[model samples]
Target: MNAPSGASGYDAVVLGGGVAGCVLAARLSEDADRSVCMVEAGPDYGAEPRHWPHKVLNARALPRDDVWERHTAVHRIRARVLGGSSCINGCWNTWGSATDHEEWVRAGGPRWSASAMERHRLRAVEQMGLRAVPERELSLWARAALEAAEELGYGHVAMAAPGRPGFGTPLINAVDGVRWNAAFAYLDAARQRPNLTILSQTTVNRLDVRTGRVRGVELDVDGRRETVVADTYLVACGTFGSPALLLRSGIGPADHLREFGIRTEVDLTGVGANLSDQPGIFVPLAPTPDLNAALAAKEASGNLYVSRMLIRAASDLCPDSSWDLHILPSAGAPLFGSLPPGQYEAGISAFLMKPASRGHVRLRSADHSEPLDIDPAFSTDPDGHDIAVLRSGLEIVERMAVSAALKPLAGAAQGHPSRDLSDEEIRSRLGAYWHPVGTCAMGQDDDPWAVVDEEARVRGVSNLRVVDASILPTVPAANTQLPVLTVAEMLADALRTDGR
Candidate 1:
């Protein structure tokens, strides 16, 4: 490994080159006075073989040596690149609503209200060049299904604020039919700054903390061990990586850290607790005789936005809820398996956004080389509210399937063949989207599990912070990418406001 000639230590070191890390690296280096170093355990975005826009094509194809093709779980998708999941995720963006941030505040995120979140969202969209465009009517299957949902009391939600609902939501990360991931939005700009340096394909094993202060880091690069010293450090390695790294570094619960023969830095019990993810349901649509020709004509053109249903989870069986509906214009290739050809396959996916169940992440071995246990403990929500919401979602599917506009596209229902099945059967096939949140939670000192404070500073530790989705006490009602970026944006503003 070759190090830069003058490279030594940086003013700030950002672990993980994912969306949040990229934003922080860019924003912190804006002043040019502070030197920022962003380290990614993945490959550079340009060299990665598979890209976000071509995910469908890759889905049909098998995996190769592409850095974007790393699977975090047995049957899940993860991208290990400079842009992290943004380099390989579906190009759909869900800018969370004001209520989402309000929920965050209630959950213990400090100094972050719904209004503050809105300002950050606006700034993010403006930077991404998300312009509203007219919806093209070529995809009849999607159009028909959306129309059916409307008739059944589910209206289209404009991804924009100000309460004007419409059919299309602007694609923030997609510019002129190309994928514009976080690498392009933040990391690319940061690369030009002399003070900002990015190191890729390096995995951080642990931290070097002395007297409750972060001093440096220990890393493994190409089968070699190296050390890096930094004045301040921030961990933005998403939900899993951050907590696992902290745990491996003996910065978690004192008892847990002791079992691994590592001395404890802090007894942060909530370092890897309160994990949550949304469940998903896909309803397919049939095609008309002219569907092929019509789709071909409008190829490279699409609504590219989600027309979602802000429905609740289930009956009030649980304090929290599960399963919110997302009426996307089109579905990506089947997440679970293959779909039969010649079917007009438009879909409405219902995600269990407000799930009552919770899970946690832990290290199976003290070894940093081993994969962490994801222990989602999914489908075990005590109230069974997730099942109930999905059942309601299934009823919605049935209603839309039989609608005047949708029946033509949905030639026949498969499961029950002649009739819709009972709620029990629908619950059987429901699954989850891979949006994980809340492992290293944020809260006040009064909170038993609070790992960091409102300003993202690690409690009991100086010059060490966590600036990622891991700090979210609870998952929001929308996709995590947008919210995570918004968190970084707000933090950046706070840092600037403090002149630190």
Candidate 2:
């Protein structure tokens, strides 16, 4: 973390040094004149991969370290490290369906179209070092799952590039077993800049807003209070953190901020609304003896990837030529809890990629350290569209589990979660894929709930912009890592152009 020298303050104070924050700081600092400071709540651990925790570097399993919480609720869990969720996710990267872009183009104009974003997308790919899964990394279960999808009439399709719905491996940001996070990609070289500052383990309390502008940011640095003034304050604190920061600064619904006894600066109703995440249901299966032995051998070689391929299958409710469900199968160490020395857990999971159900994030209090109140509200849409689509996906899971290609290795399904339960039971046992977006959504000024404009600048507040997943009005039907990185890179380009 950097300190306050004789220099007054930074040119741009980028709050929340997550995926987007790292990119913004690196790109903006390229000019050699713009002073940029990146504030992150978690420890930076320096710029070397060897300096990072071993658990964080291992890509075979999602690490519990460097996260916001360590409870049983997976949906509420979020990364708090400099690299953010990229340091803790499954490393699967997918460009969502074409229909998702149509929605983005409508909300954010032609600049968000597929053709427009392609350049930025390719740049992110190169910077992040995303690559296809190699043959050595695929476990026997993954191979069998691929054959199973093929047997079921689905052909192999590239998951990284936008294309028709099919099954194939996703582009991964991992090499060997190390997790290649955004900090390593974007922030390593930027740290050498004399004008760039990386502040870690520093908490942002709130923004000092008066009238229609932000004056400075109130931060809690090493138990001491400080105020950092900047020409512009950009909030890239992610989907949950971004909204909570706005609400604590008195920018959310006037009625909600009043409940916290905070002074209101702007009454933005969409600061923490429209939370979207992919909810999934896992169907357990009894692994065959040979399958267990094969998995054991793979683990011995340190090349065991629980899931290497995924099926993007279109449900009845999905838009034509686009998929709304991600069917994943896995056989490895349990995602939660543990298995015996030689035994492993096997299952097929159905993820509702394009859910219609919307949720929200709210501040429990004005305190910055306290957790925000988050309600994913999965499968709660009034029309039951999410429920219907999820059930349809599970139906596919059941068929895949019993298919000849998979049955020989996984034996038989213990019982499908949806076989005999009501919709309530289905909802109770559901787990999240951990791809969340849309808290501070983007829109035109006329839209009542729009928090930011197409340029990601917050409404009614000059010089305050939000460039993260929170600004996405709709969740794409794919993992959020790639999309968020692409958005940050694109916005950084625009901001650099303006400064020039």
Candidate 3:
């Protein structure tokens, strides 16, 4: 369906039709009295599964070729679609631990505590159709991994269920081979509502602010410049995009904005600081003959090659807290990237779920068309805390590889350049799991770097809020899709209660 002409005067304008944007648009529009508009920079295939691209619908391989790439090796992927990264991500549905939200409460307030966020989590789970791929349907490789973990005494643990933590098959937001992205799960049901308008292929240049109040947004629609007026404006453009939008709107650090010749609206130093991601390293293992044969047979049966098993555990760094490491295995090596033909290989991708290192996203120019400078600063913590956690995770992977259950299926370990390496060598191999957060962190008023408040309202600005991974003061201990959805749900609930 074509977007309505002359888009203007919406009760709430949600920029970036990503996971959070979709949730906010749907929930806010439910009032029937409020008018909502969702704008996406990429193509929106409407609400039909048939309309979606085959690459996007497939829940097996991630569509990384279609994403926007940054210069950094650790933080490179960003999907520009209606569902955002949810449309092109590994379908791992992990809610993390209750402690993750507790940390948020400590940073923000009581409203962000674990108990307060539970309702939203339940709502997201039901709405997204999150469930485990039955053991009957598990790939041979995934089953073997689960068996191996069990042999090592980790036992079967449900990662998707709330507050339950142990080693188990990871649940996914996939049903019957189709990836149930946020757009399909949330926005589809609300698209028909006359109060909601979805504008595809529309890029938001910046928000229009006057005297500390946001009046509307300036957009580049179909090569034509236009202004979209709204009482409230929400930036749900993920971690990088949200901060970039704020910076372009002259609402970031004063020195940075003045350097670009743009007038400063809000001198918020924390607009793009405090970036964090899950630092990870992949250990490739040559598959034994028996495992190789099983993989071939499984592939011939037309089953997905990806593994669903994930092991979450805490390292010695945080023994008292919840799990801080995620050990994920893949059936085939080529599933992630190119490999030698006929070489059957699987890899253990382990990440430090709670990283200590922080990074930042800054504007290269005032132009909206230019990409922002994203530096995740992987393993760069001053106290060497990030590297310590990552090294411990690697040690766990090594143990898993040499375990009795996996001995029959595992062969020699393959490392980058060579198999033998020092601690520093391993640290150099550190990469990211592509989960970036905390760029536009929400904190109390006294905090100098806090960009938003507990209510998600942008600091020093009226009628403008940020609702995405950017507002997360810290990254969650699991895949960010569920947490981002839950946060958006909580924000929507708050907005509803405010009666705005």
Best by TM-score: 2
Worst 10 residues of 2 by lDDT: 1-10
Model 2 agreement with the true structure over 1-500: per-residue lDDT tens digits:
65453324878999988899989999999988899888999889789999999999899999987887777488998889999988999988999989989999888999899889999999999999999998999998998899999998998898988888999999999999889999999999889899998888888999998988888898887777788889989999999999999999989899999998998899999989999999999888999999999999999999998888999999888889899999999889998899999899999999999998999999898998888899999999999999898889988998898888899988665554456767998999899999889999999878998999988989999989999999988999899999999999999998887772
The TM-score ranking, best first, is 2, 3, 1
Candidate 1 C-alpha RMSD relative to the actual structure: 4.2
Rate residue 260 of model 2 by lDDT: 87
* Selected candidate, larger TM-score, 1 vs 2: 2
Q: Residue 93 deviation, candidate 3, in Å?
A: 0.8
Q: Comparing 2 and 3 by TM-score, which wins? A: 2
Give the Å error, residue 114, model 1.
Answer: 1.3
For TM-score, candidate 1 versus 3, the one ahead is 3
Shift in Å, residue 66, candidate 2: 0.9
TM-score of each: 0.85, 0.98, 0.95
Runs in model 2 with CA error above 4 Å? 5-7
Whole-model lDDT for model 3 versus the true structure? 0.82
